[model samples]
Target: SELSEIHSALKEIEELESDNAGAEAPKNLAGAIKVQVDRVIRAYRTLLGMSGHAQEVLEVGENPDEEWKNVWLLLRRDLQKSMPRGSELEKAWHEAFNVDAEVAFEAALEVRDLAALMLVGVRYPFAPAALRATKASADLAFAEGQRALAAKGYSALMALEPFQSVSRQDLALAAIKGYLCTRELGWRKAEGEFKSWIDANPAAAVLWGEERKPIGALLLDFEKAIPSFDTLELQLGESLVSMPMATLAGQPSKAEPKNLETQAWPSLKIKGPLSPRTSYAMKNLLEVEVSPVIPTVTPTSILVNTGEALYGFDFLSGKSLWGDGVRLEAPRDAFHYSEQDPNLILTAARWQDLVIAPLENPLSKSTDAPKAKSSFGGSVFSHFPVVRRALVGVDQASGNILWTLGGQYRLRSDQASLPDLEKRIAVTSFFTLTVVDDVIYALGTTRENESQLHLVAIDPAQGKPMWSVLLGAGQGESNMFGNPMRDAMPGIPVVAEGVLYVQSNLGAVMAVEIASQRVLWVSRYEALPRPFTRIRSTAYRKVTHANGAPILTRDKKGNLLLIVAPTDSRFITAFDAESGEVRWRTQTENAQ
Candidate 1:
């Protein structure tokens, strides 16, 4: 009987222990079940710690192998049972932990996942907050050379959260800075991000107006940020529209449209003291001839024409000398002036004939005044030997042309002609020519393509070609106008210090050696696909020497004052001439 009782007692004890374990579960218990779940999690963490591989193995998540799923389920159930109702901290903690677990699980499941982790975070509730912290931490780590840690942290955060307004702003800025520093994102991506930011933040529009970067790029952003219709309307009203005017019948007339026809009117009346009659009388009677002739002696007398029909006058006295029947028809483009010679006057006739005349001393008015001479047989410059051929030369004291050259060239019988050479050689209807040190340079496209640029140097003395350089061969494909047949043409080459500086419509500025015909250096404006297209046109002022280097200027807005000089490494630097440093740098949000 005593043995039987002992066995029954032992059986009852075993049953009670089993029931107690079952009751501890969340489904069975009403309160304090969290303690039991906490105990289990602590045990598992301890096991993880002991193994020294918990971080590595659990990188994907705490239960990466799905073996921890049951354990997690148990813990979660117990914690839910243990938590009090309506607890915000508990809710937040649950949400955060759940997201973290999901991220870990996904990471562990796919070792070769090519998808972005940050993109995954977009679907999670707590991702935004987590990502912010992670990004900040990663930034710090990157600075400290902890690359692996930083990367891991960034990936994890990206996987855990969606981007928020503040975070997106930060990312956009980072992207911009990265583009500036590494040029990795490229102009297109950088521009897109900048645009997105501006669109989202209209009140913060001033940030987009920073002129540190290329103006073309900034202009793109500005256009997107500001309403184009309103801006255009404002500009039109300010510049293109005219005010109403009173009619001869005493009724007011509506403002006339500003167009070619209106602008081309023979006479434009203004409401001022300078009326039609007074202006015409004054212009005819008191108009001092503005001469196109500019003459300079070795060091003394310099005579200039004031365009008046009177005889040539001394530049200092304005007194007419050697009055003659010769009168200029088109005062604007008919005459060529040379300040280097004071006594000689040169002019071209409507039919392409040139004449050289000498002026007498106005103070004397004696018959001994210098006699005028003429060289009027053929085109002076042989290349463009026919009518309208461009020419520049210095005349010898004798009645002969000293040195005359033309840009139009003809291929010899044995030499193959470039099919496009004529097109390339053909001068634009409107172009300018400049002569420096007896070498003549011409700027304009020849006939082959409208954008085709040819820079030809001619020997003014022999009417022979010295060198010719072409720019913008492949510019057509990249042009915005979709004209693939076009190319970047050369503007007038500015000569200084034996170096010929040339600007191209393709955004390249090149310096060439006059003697060797070699390219010394080249720099480009990198903001636009074709930055030159944005420029209405280019005009170069004379090069001024500063600090033993030549500084060049262009009329382009930001590039108005640019410096071009050689560096110690044989490289050329183009920066702001005023600052003597690169001025077009800006701080973007993204920097790497």
Candidate 2:
């Protein structure tokens, strides 16, 4: 009963903290909770000889990726043991922060007692002084043109690993600065890598480009501030693609676009009822009122969840893989299944978060431009639906919730009271879950100067974001699928040859360098629609969802082609996968 009560207390505390992110908790209340937790731990330890035990986190290793992952696990442990709990620095970490990168570095720099620290026998580990101070020293070296010392310092800092958003901020700074050091030394291959780190990792560059606070805003970059940059959309050539869809190298036209909603399967029959709400939004088919949103669908079975429940069947044999369906908090579009780890099911969702949808021409210079949404008739034209989801891993064999991401979720990056941390929702819900080499690549909508999609690669085991960046345009708005809900998201990111091919429903396709998280090129095939295109229902305007999924394949000569053949259009357009160059556009047999 004490353990159960402790769990309940933690949940209630999370809810209270969630209600007021920018405020301090009542001191008495916090003290009371801490006492209770201590009492519970003491009792459990005395009675049961242990409170609990988790699988030991993997140690930092030779693999850079693994080191990045295990960094936080060890960092949290070190910080707890190293820092005096009630110190001001520790308190600063408890609150949400947006401190300047230079300021933090300077604080570490101000610690002029290296001989004293040496007397304390501290090594280059995750301890605050070692991490922050060393990183600061390296940053100062870079700023002062001490390339050799900075390189060594950054290398040491990189090896230290980090835990929580704050230390991670330092780690990211160290990585980028290290890359700069490498570039300055004229190591060609390593220079590209350093530059790529700055591009792929938002924390390393765009988000931290300035020496400002909030430098540690990793996953909490829900409403990021953006400078007004051109969005850098690529242009498609006037040339036409001569190849037809059916004749494309690896794509079988008849076997493709085969869904229960779009096409009928004569041999397949619906055995029984599934979700209470059968229909969902599909970016490819804006013409249709609704479509299916399953995270994992294979030739043998389909796995779908709407925060209510989840299950799939071995269709060929009519065997239920997820028999009773695991109950969920809400329906979700993201799901991860790996052949390597077949027993684990990873799902992430966000519930009831705030989003300020950009109005039509809010920056329009002309006074006569439309200001309809935020003006007099704004209320009638708007609808606020419940937005909540969860980030969790389920046991595939038992249909059970195995682990959750936030709010007492052990693998958390930090113990801060983040508002939407537990919900784990994205800017755009994951349409398709992507797991490549044990890393999950997912999308979120960012509301900055322009509507742009954000990509974050996460480690499912820890629920920690490895890196993040802007994928392309058509973000933070309802324009993608023209849905009334107006939830922002980009196209499903399809990864091939270290390149992620994403088709934003608003007439654009972007190729992102997966390894670096950089947008190689973005080609806009159609014009972007005006804001509020859906509710206004303007007559005869073309919407971007008329497109199909990205088809990536290399010819015998080994040239990759990113092809798109819209259902409403007769011509099939092809872009050279390597360069985003328009190859050709030719008419198919069925011309509209």
Candidate 3:
């Protein structure tokens, strides 16, 4: 009966708190509820042989001395031991949390004196039930604007693996609020914590809406006062990225002319190499891939995948933000670097916590096709190693793996239909994963036909499939020796104004409507060499990895032009974006 009365009083206090009553209201409610809890604790203590421990706690009201913390520790142990498994007090505690979180918060605080008890190493049980009760109570504290109490709750929850998923974001948010609410601890610790949260969830830096500006202002003040050059640099860079492009450029750049007639040039000019220097230190190219297509640029940070590990670094500082380098799955091959070979690990895309990368066979000395077997079995070609897929999602902040969506290309040759064995080949390849409107689209292929390709869309939020469509047979590829390796060019998917353009290795380009996922149009061309062109034994060609990636550029009239260069050829075709109509076709003698 006393337990039920105390629970009722606790519930009433929580209801007032939930109503967001005046500041004095909670203290008044807690004060009244505290008296009842004291009586219950006293009764329970005598029954559990814990007399005289907390007698002073009740007599002195809420101003329990430091000794009260130890009293609670002994009282909790004896109370749990003495109370029957289904005692009224235990039932009350459970119901108080389940029905009214405020009640649980008040009750737990009044009896165990949470903050004071925590200082004395007195903690609730770590069992799942205990964890849930603690979390529920802590959540109420946050709801009531009790920053310190909420931070304590989050700290404990973070240490428990099972609760980490639920607690991490809330804990981060709570830490931000706690830092703002108190200056008892040095501002450096608070400032560092606030910045850490931003790095962990860059997207969340502006999560507070109108409050974001104030937070930014506070951070600016800290930056000015703090002696850390790195922190100031980071804050400055963050501010710059938040600015509009026009503001950063000083003046708005001229936009493409809406109705200017398209012009044709005689040849693509070789102004300079893509990089300022023609040579690339393979060791430092985490962003670049085998495909000639350039890496995606992030304004504030650089994200790169070196096959073995995904790395995030501060663009300004050149310091690593996070990486799984210590636990590398496959180290980079020293021989390939010595030989100036194209690194096989390709970084697909990086956006906040979502990083898409694909790892291929790193040990392959060459991307060249195997030589055809000599007639009469004079010399048989070696078996091609199985090609595996290594597309994966990594959390950029923590360098933790989110999901892996790649596999080795294989077929059921044993149960083969005649066409199956003829076309079945295990070829490992990395397809670039593109994100459009929060949906992830990546190219996939079947061994049955190199010309055939699949466009797979996934929900990057959870790495789940949204839809997959076969875009029909396109083209095939060949080795430098002009031998058929596979048909179909594996071009990176490019999105322009909600339309996706994909190219098969052989040179069939198609545009798909992003929203409807429908093929808008298909354009085919002879992009690969028709007959075998023998690559003479020379070092002029150097590394033989070639990707016929389709390029998306705005025409003179502001319309997107899909330009594609045929593999091993000098012909380039530009197609109208909306209608897939050929805009212009050109050929050059010495350009690829």
What lDDT would each prediction earn against the true structure? 0.34, 0.43, 0.47
Residue 173 lDDT, candidate 2, scale 0-100: 66
Model 3 per-residue lDDT tens digits across residues 474-549: 4544333332355332455666545778766445678887668789999876554434222221111211124424
TM-score (C-alpha, index-matched) for candidate 1:
0.26
lDDT string for model 1 (1-592, tens) is 3334434433443343345543442332312332343444556555555677354223335634333433342333333443334443234334435556466435733552222233233223233433544455545544444333344444444333222234544543333333222211112443454445444543331233343343335434544432111101112323554322221111111122222222222221111111111111111222222222322111111222221221233222333333332222222222221111111122221101111221111111132111222236311211101011233332312223333332232334543454443333433211223344446555444443234455566554454455666643542332121212224444334554355665554446666666666666666653223112212111221111111223455433323344533211122445543333454433322433
| Model 2 Cα shift for residue 66 (angstroms) | 42
Candidate 3, superposed: residue stretches over 4 Å from native = 1-293, 306-309, 321-345, 361-378, 409-430, 449-451, 474-484, 526-560, 565-567, 590-592
1 against 2, candidate with superior TM-score: 2
Instruction: Point out the worst 10-residue segment of candidate 1 by lDDT.
Output: 378-387
Model 2 C-alpha RMSD vs. true structure (Å) is: 27.8
Q: In model 3, how large is the Cα lDDT of residue 506?
A: 48
